[model samples]
Target: MKNVVIAQSGGPTSVINNSLRGAIETFLSSGKIGKIYGARMGILGVLNEELVDITAQDPKQIKLLERTPSAGVIGSCRYKIKSQEDLERIVEVFKAHNVGYFLYCGGEDSMDTANKVSLLARERGLEVICVGIPKTIDNDLGGKLQEDGTFAICDHDPGYGSVARNTAINVLEANEENKASYTSDPVLVIGVMGRKMGFITASARLADPRREMPLLIILPEALSQDDYKSNLEYITEKVNEVLKAHKRCIIVIGEGVNVGDLGILKDSFGHAQFSAAEKSAEQVLANYLNGLDRKDEKGRARSRLVVSGIARYEKPGTRQRREIAYVSEVDLREAYEVGAYAAKLALNGETGYMATIRRIPGEKYQVEYSKIPLNVVANSAREFPKKWISENKVDVTDDFVKWAMPLIGGPLPEFANFKEIMAPKLCRDYIPAGLREQGA
Candidate 1:
């Protein structure tokens, strides 16, 4: 029997701990593994010799991990291995700990890290099995587009379902709040977390499939921030159109929607660090709209029909990704299955592969666990398909709703509504002072 080590990397998710738990319990039951160790703080833990003996932890607490959200237990990190010295040190530490099997849980960058480590172990003649576990709310890991417009590599990353459900529920609640408060704040701009991809932002549409709400969704894939002036003008026009028809509007924007040079930071992988950025997409759009002079197509000042108040913005930040209350039962189950599958692969001597999920072809929701080459997943990225974007580029098509609706699982939270009949007027109608002054 050989010893095993497990570690997590990159951002935490509502179901990430469940995956860890799955891997731990599976390995323990296999009886082909020795001491089970957890690498604290991801690869950083390996470098610093900070290994936690999972075999010594309380079994009750281990079981609780099924409901525990985030990666606070063994921890996770964004540190990237860049040197031969670091690689050598990792192998040395692993040899000292008698670690023969390694399971890494995370997204694209983590897969790349796992692949490199597995290659290095082979080069150094170390007997080890390395398996990658897929996890990300962005759903950008890797995949091929199916004929039915679904992704094939992994139907969807594990954390995406929960976050999609979160966004849907949030939009439902925001609609209620917007309806009540739009008299004062006519526009509510909600900023969601999804850098470079629109999965998180597009999920808001799932809240209202009938297109009943006066909602506008802005995705980074649909708009180009390089031409800030034109982009701003286009979005302003869309919002005004919605306002003219419905008195109030709700805008959902992705955090990565190129709001033009907000002093963006970069991580080791050179990906934009939106969290560290000074300004968010929603804040920028709100400020721009609030400061506008209400000009017409001729660039002349005009009195708009429903520009009652300035737009208010909210950036939920990490709360969108880590909130346990919003987790989907489907996502939690898949996360655990993938983790266990990775353990099974390691025990069976599989190496340089990632545990992937594929949605079965059927009317009912179903999925099966499989494996894919880590190199392929590490080098590829799945983008929000352009065909899914609406003709106006401000919304997603019904096809998108069909693809994501099943993942969220169960009935969405419902809101209350009363008869919209207006009360009879007691006095004669008169022109408002603001409209009169504008000479309308």
Candidate 2:
């Protein structure tokens, strides 16, 4: 029997489980494969030889996976597998389990690891093949054409749409809060997702498709250092102008935006998650507006307002990604398909390839699955389309809406309102040394 091993790593996504389900379903339905095993917590588990034979349990566990949220089930890690020692450890585990196919699910870094394993396996004459499934909310994988500016990978990634909806609605709801509280807090500023790539940052435009909202988006790459302060000043002036007519104005700031003194979060890949643990860009802007210069055109005292980031990772950002209600059905299907593709590649004697989502040009929002060299994917970075951004660079253009609106689908996701939850493992009691040695 050709035993198969599957694992996931990096940050978790709303549909990460769907990909896992796809791979399990593929392996179970195929005769070439036998018992399916999962590394309890990704490559680290593989190195530790703590393999869980999931196939021994009822296959219905796959169903639970679809609903299961976060990386807690099989677990995931940020530990980079870059050394020869790590590679040696993986070979021993795969040999121990008679694993013929190794299916990995994660972003570019994970893919690179998978590629290395494939090379080592071939050198050692092991028959196993390795394949990667792309999963990141940042959507930093894949590339777009510099010509038409459309992404080569599917328009948006699976995880991004849900967060996009969250940001959109969060901005919409914040509008209510901003408008209502603007009298006391005249300026409403929000931080968004996007460190280097503006994918998450640009999605804020979807909140107000008409560009009617007084939204100001800032991204790391939006401008050079010299123009950043001028941009903030422009936004403050606009906030004041809007305040003249109404009590408050809604301001949207990207987490990656250079709000002078605000801080940002960098993931394992060094890409920013835009989480504000230190201080938010919104707070920075609020402080700036509050402490205006000695003199002004009208000599009106600046007013303070509210500041928040709708989807920052610093403060338990899982709720925004895991909640099923906010997930896009379109994304759900694509995620599953991508996972299935990864499994198929593992079976087809193909290795060192990522199951890439590619957008088909034309009317219907269609995608074709193809293989890209993992090395290419590792080095490349995808950003929000420049043309997609309007002149202000805060909002996405109508074309951006047309491309993204379809990816999210029309129907809202059906998630239980009360919400099922998970907690950390608790140690009930300590066992004696003798008991512990005996595997108690």
Q: What lDDT would each prediction earn against the true structure?
A: 0.89, 0.70
Those runs of model 2 whose alpha carbons end farther than 4 Å from true positions after fitting are: 146-149, 225-228, 244-246, 261-276, 292-318, 411-440
Worst 10 residues of 2 by lDDT: 307-316
Residue 344 error for model 2, in Å? 1.4
TM values, all candidates: 0.94, 0.83
Backbone collision tally, model 1: 0
Considering every candidate listed, which one attains the maximal lDDT? 1
Model 1 stretches astray by more than 4 angstroms: 292-306, 430-440
List model 1 lDDT by residue over 335-411, tens digit each. 99999999999999999999999988767778999999888898578989888899897999998998899888788
